[model samples]
Target: AGHSITTIEGLEKDNKLHPVQEAFVKEQAAQCGFCTNGLVMCAVSLLKINPDPDDQEIRDGLQRCLCRCGTQSRAIRAIKRVIG
Candidate 1:
């Protein structure tokens, strides 16, 4: 296994959060936060594939990750913020 992996912790550099993380925080996208890590990871992966995804595409990209805290709307806003 010669694959490189990046976790949530690895997304930070120079004490600065990644754009996605920053957006998430700014939007208060995490309520309970139980699903925050997964949501963040999914968002990162989605953006990697599609840097400028539309609202529906963003929804579709994050659909696989479940957030029981009802923070999906905020998360979408955060992703849109990153896109902008």
Candidate 2:
């Protein structure tokens, strides 16, 4: 277990949106919503280590995440939008 972790709820502060959140909203990346949090967390972690990952890299990084809403491609685009 990690001593520190950032949940989806932890991504915002001071009435401002986190970059990832802005990207997601702008890209309309979420659907149904159940998997949004997990996917966001995965993207956050990936960005921390690889700020400019390619699309396939992003997909590989988030392979464990399941988005029943069919927002996988949109979510990956959102992360790219934020990092670029």
Candidate 3:
């Protein structure tokens, strides 16, 4: 048996943006965009377990991700948008 995997590209469905991806775009969450994929994936995983995490919880969950382009705040906003 094999676990399923979904990359950032895999988030699209039938040529449309997944809600999470739409949220990211609406929030302008990426700067250089280098960390966008990984961050989005992490957010997806976190939201799955905790659909409505608080600000601190969201911060704690994404602490492992790094973005030299300084998009952390917007990334947090993006995740919140999807959760709501």
Best by lDDT: 1
Q: Quote each prediction's TM-score.
A: 0.94, 0.90, 0.90
Residue lDDT tens for model 3, 43-72: 888888899999998998788887788888
Name the TM-score of candidate 1.
0.94
lDDT of 3: 0.86
Report lDDT (CA) for all predictions: 0.94, 0.87, 0.86
lDDT of candidate 3 at residue 7, scale 0 to 100:
87
Clashes of each: 0, 0, 0
Off by over 4 Å in 3: none
How big is the positional error of residue 67 in model 1, measured in Å on the Cα after superposition?
Answer: 1.6
Q: Counting only residues 3 or more apart in sequence or on different chains, how many pairs clash (N, Cα, C under 3 Å) in candidate 1?
A: 0
- The TM-score-based order of candidates, best leading, equals 1, 3, 2
Give the worst 10-residue stretch by lDDT in candidate 1: 61-70
User: What's model 1's overall lDDT?
Assistant: 0.94
Per-residue lDDT tens digits for candidate 1, residues 50-72, read 99999899999999987779999
